[model samples]
Target: MDKKLAAEHLLQDVSHYHGPMIRQMKQLVDIYIKLAELETRREDTNRKVALPREIRSVKQLELVPVVTATIPVDRSCQYNEGSFPFFRGLSDSVTVMNGINAPKVVECFGSDGQKYKQLAKSGNDDLRQDAVMEQFFGLVNTFLHNNRDTWKRRLAVRTYKVIPFTPSAGVLEWVDGTIPLGDYLIGSSRSEGAHGRYGIGNWKYPKCREHMSSAKDKRKAFVDVCTNFRPVMHYFFLEKFLQPADWFVKRLAYTRSVAASSMESIFTFDDIYPLSA
Candidate 1:
């Protein structure tokens, strides 16, 4: 064929071969652009949708209420036993409870008062002494309980139910438990142990010994599998168990410290006022 005719024929063949592919590529690009636009629209819609007022209000509510009571220091009062006095002025009571002052040292004329006096005297000024420590710890416990709601709110803590995987089912078949997120996030020994065993150990299997004639061969295969699997299992355990456990523990410790600091900031020695003489 002449050069001009040959070149024309070659160009025709090239277009014939590449025409469908070029058309398909353009269609794919159009589809991708449409998908990108849809995704952007979806994100914008999500951002614009506000939470319902009722749900928002419920979220704002405290997880638990502050529990406080008028614990009487007076043993002589007839109604002191198993009786919690309700003050009319809630604000005044809170002020008294949280006010800063040295703890009141009341002289006990009765037997109970005498015992209180003796206990206090034994502790002297050392809050760490047995009797004083008990009192201090008791107060600390109350303080923590009272402010639990505050800490939960500050941390934006939310509860969720988690089901764990069973050993036989493996991760694919594992179901989450129905426990509250608050409880699960606390990182109990039971949860940690279960996760460690199932996530790391469940995949390990004994060697198939049907083809092996010698016991030594079977044993060697088993040992080899176990040895090779150790690092993989260790990595899974660290990723799924140890790291999460550490994070949970640190958060809990921080919450406790915040609670303690909150208590210290509000309470004073004077708040432990002496009972009426």
Candidate 2:
């Protein structure tokens, strides 16, 4: 009951644009995915109609990008010093990413004759706190790296630039080629139906009961089975790996490493003792 309430409370401030943003992102990705398929088909169609090598290269070079949307007149995007100071303006090719918040992948031009891809996100309760947390984590990672007592690989903490445009909005340096851990665990796209979120429905083994049709019923079922939550969570663990025992062994080692790093980061900082102790 408490957990369900907390989840609702957290999502209370979800922006009205959240749904549109997700739809836009999906639409954009779908367009690109279809375009890629069409390109493959075109290549097959042109297989027999081969041109000269030089002509082929020229044709490829002639494929200039077209701007589909009108550029915004408000070209100026201000950022604090040391955070993309050379950033000049936004490009027309804005990509909405898949998520509840629906972040945008914006192309920014720099004065140094280069382009950068930054993630522009809005509809946050407070992004300033997120920026602060990132900065503090970076500091902790630096401390761990400098200390010889830390792991051999050091704290492989990835830090990127975060510029808060407002209390509830910000631009983050885009990290390419990343997958969500939740997606990794699921091994594919989320399941179908309204209550298809991870660990929400009934597990596969020893089929306890049918999955509730409505979201409210699903939530109620999940909450009622909280006492036997281990089996429910274990279902996901098994889903992630074929061999449960082997997965458990590896998970323990990974958990220990993460826990040690967390402890070291907190205890090493003298400022944390007063608050934590």
Candidate 3:
């Protein structure tokens, strides 16, 4: 063979050998990038879980169960008639409050003059007339506030023993009997006002119940309720679930990625043919 032709042939052979290897290397690099992304996600989840409860931004107020009584529904009214009354009432109140710009804390008075006298003595200028009358029917402002405060007290007591950075599963189990911490944390249970069911805290408004029971309106009601309330429930549940450390660990596992180097170690051609050679 001619020397030049022989050299050319050898060069072509080398190119053929390296072409697939280059492609494989590119694939390996892509895999590594994916792996790194997965690792970063895992780290973020772990960090979120490790964060202290106080710093987590999951407010106790957010977990407070919506007051059942405050949901307006007239038993005598038809389902469609009462279905949206609760939201309407809220909107009305917001409009009034916007117009009034009432202080964050308002002094409420009973029928008696004595209550008004006491408030006046306290020098509270935020007092409003007939605050109770101003409130949406069936929705008592004080009752909701009181209930929220009570829930906070209970939650604070229950969570007092929960050590920071500890797995929430055991703590949840320990407090399960006292409060449905596990249920709320996991959000496995359906929420009130979900699926056209206007129930909250084991009781549904009589009008809502009647409406939901009607076969003709059931599907529509579900759609409306889910549309209006599902997002609220989702937000609340997600916040609740992330409050625990175990969830963080679970999230990391769910999003974990294999490193590129690890993949290369298992499948690289360097093992068969030394790269140095």
Candidate 4:
């Protein structure tokens, strides 16, 4: 994923009118090898495509690259510097989602609205919700520009949903490299529905039951995964469990987790973070 991102960065730095010589090097290398093999196999046998007699005439990048076991886009590969800052990846086993896939699910609701009810029942409330959220996200500015009540209700639902997400404000960031969370993440422990104080993602108000007061501690309430939870993962005790979740939005010049102490952190930082400065 980071390799693709690095390639993207490099591509952007180059041209739209024409491809860069560095990128063309990939194809050039492959073609060069094929030509060399063809030449070797054909001391007596001949092929239509012969190896170019004068390789020096091709003023391409020095194709005789130094050998390395890994794709070194680090301090060593000076040309790729800042292009792909290599980082530790998830255990070579897990399939993590890259940002390229922003899946959009569209479902129509007839006047009966039975589809929404059916989806909410057939263990697909998440699908219904995401579709609704996707539409809400798509046309809000225009929706607000047109009608007042519709806009307020829309905004109200959004705000209410985010009431729990506020805990994850830890993930929201601003330019100049500031974590917008302020002090919200310190004491919050998110559970079903509301993000408590440490959770992320939109809360399903109908499905959520939250408490942050002393009662949560006094009642011996433990964060447990209930059968009703949408994404279907086991429960977690915030004090003991952590997952390093991350996403970027708002085209927002937000910083990302450069490093983390654990996998549960919503937004982590290390030395290389705050690179924006």
Candidate 5:
């Protein structure tokens, strides 16, 4: 009885502080308490097992019971469950992103007078895999940051919050003042205006375009080219460079340095770097 009283006091003290760990502990406590009540109810018919008045009164702190079923058995369940976490406070005005897909940039206002933005997209591809990779990269970055000896340079992987609404749709945290890497590469190549920014006036592009245009069956020709891609890729590397070879070598090095740092984090693994392809 004394041990139980001491444990309850310790729990109360810990509950005063809030964080992810605290919330997890609270969830475990709630589960245990429910189980204890159930056992007590089964033991004696006359016994009335109830939660403490303090625990019952803290409605906001209580965690809602999770539905284990894949499909909801109750149609009248609250809409907030498994729905977009934020929508009621979203602003009406939305801006379109500059890209082929043209995702929407949505804005929302928080109760604390803070503004949040998300890039919302609806497409056939599921972004859950992207989210998982982002999270994994984040964990790797965290390790690198903590261990300064392993990596001297301060390089952190860029990641954004991803919330998947469904299998085919999702929203990502908006990152401002950034353009696609492909666009940057093209813009750099055409900085002097000697060639089209998107290879419009490039001699190789025109030759390739003419070949496709003059083909008796355009779709079949494209399919054939794609089917045998090695020769096309070889030709591209040999003759279709938008920029000088030195410029490409430098870019390749830059990309490798970032990847190498991440690989170094797991260097202890026997197969971290394969000797042969």
Candidate 6:
């Protein structure tokens, strides 16, 4: 009994204070993952049971009742009983102090207010350092907020240029020889400036509306465009999912002839290099 009590106390402290999971399913959770096909063609699936509460402490470990389970409409339940371990997700709360993520040790300021003041008062050297951190954190926050529905939505790329590194992706984003990415992509037929059609194979530039909506808009507004373009591609820029590195590697050090790299400051990835193909 003492052993069980001790274990229960230790787990209670850890799970209560540092339990990994965004919000304990205040309600019961029923998760089902389809497994690989069995050798006999039977629909055998591995189980990943994420039980809500601690199983060992419950009465009669052999029989714990499920309070509730959330099953999406697109689910097909066909798995054996399984138990999942506890996992903690990350935290989003931040307290900025003088444009810095604060240590509970000292609190003078927070959020964006501290950021602006620090930028205004810092020396040339310090300004350069702090500004970079602030921008990185800003990007992270944006990515998290924008990805709230990542479970049901995906960032599918219609074009290959959006990938982090590829010579073809960069080659496509130039004026001297603009690869004409729009030569095949599409937009709302009503929007005059919206290019609704690119070349044949490249037609999938905007794979899906959801993905396109989450991606940075590259279309420029041409004059005589339809004024009522609520769904037009020109209205939004989704740089959150598209990281700065999606443009080019700092050094390109692996080349046979090219040598030395100079990414002196935070330049838009789109500016230095183009998206991958």
Name the candidate that leads on TM-score. 2
lDDT of 5 by residue, 96-138 (tens): 5443444556454443344666666656557776677667767
Tens digit per residue, CA lDDT, model 3, 153-251 = 221111112111111111100122233433443233433334223223333334445556774867897765454333333343344466667666544
TM-score-sorted candidate list, best first: 2, 5, 1, 3, 4, 6
- RMSD (Cα, Å) of model 4: 23.8
Candidate 4 on 1-277: residue-level lDDT in tens? 8978997787677646445544555443443232222222222321122224442233333322211111344566455423321211111111111112211111212222212100001111233343444345435435543677645433222211110111111000112322224123221222332234334554432334553233346334223323223342122223323533322231111211112112112212332264354
Clashing pairs in 1: 101-269, 101-270, 102-269, 102-270, 103-269, 160-181, 162-176, 162-177, 163-176, 163-177
User: Which residue ranges in model 3 land beyond 4 Å of their true spot?
Assistant: 1-208, 236-277
List lDDT for all candidates, in order.
0.32, 0.48, 0.30, 0.29, 0.49, 0.25
Work out candidate 1's RMSD over C-alphas.
34.4
TM-score for each candidate, following the candidate numbering: 0.18, 0.44, 0.17, 0.17, 0.42, 0.15
For every candidate structure, what is the RMSD over all alpha carbons to the true structure, in angstroms? 34.4, 16.2, 32.8, 23.8, 18.8, 23.7
Instruction: Return the TM-score for candidate 1, rounded to 2 decimals.
Output: 0.18
Residue-by-residue lDDT tens digits, candidate 1, 203-268 = 222222322344567778667555543432233334444667786665565576666555553444
TM-score of predicted model 4? 0.17
Candidate 5 lDDT trough over 10 residues, lowest sum:
61-70
lDDT for 172 in candidate 3 is 7
Clashing pairs in 5: none
Give Cα distance to truth, residue 10, candidate 4, Å: 10
Candidate 3 achieves a global lDDT of 0.30
Q: What ranges in model 5 sit over 4 Å off?
A: 1-88, 98-101, 187-257, 260-277
Question: Among all windows of ten consecutive residues in candidate 3, which has the lowest summed lDDT?
Answer: 87-96
Q: Candidate 2's residue-wise lDDT over 5-101, tens digit each?
A: 9866655544343554344433433332222122122223313222223212221111111111112334564333433323244454455555455
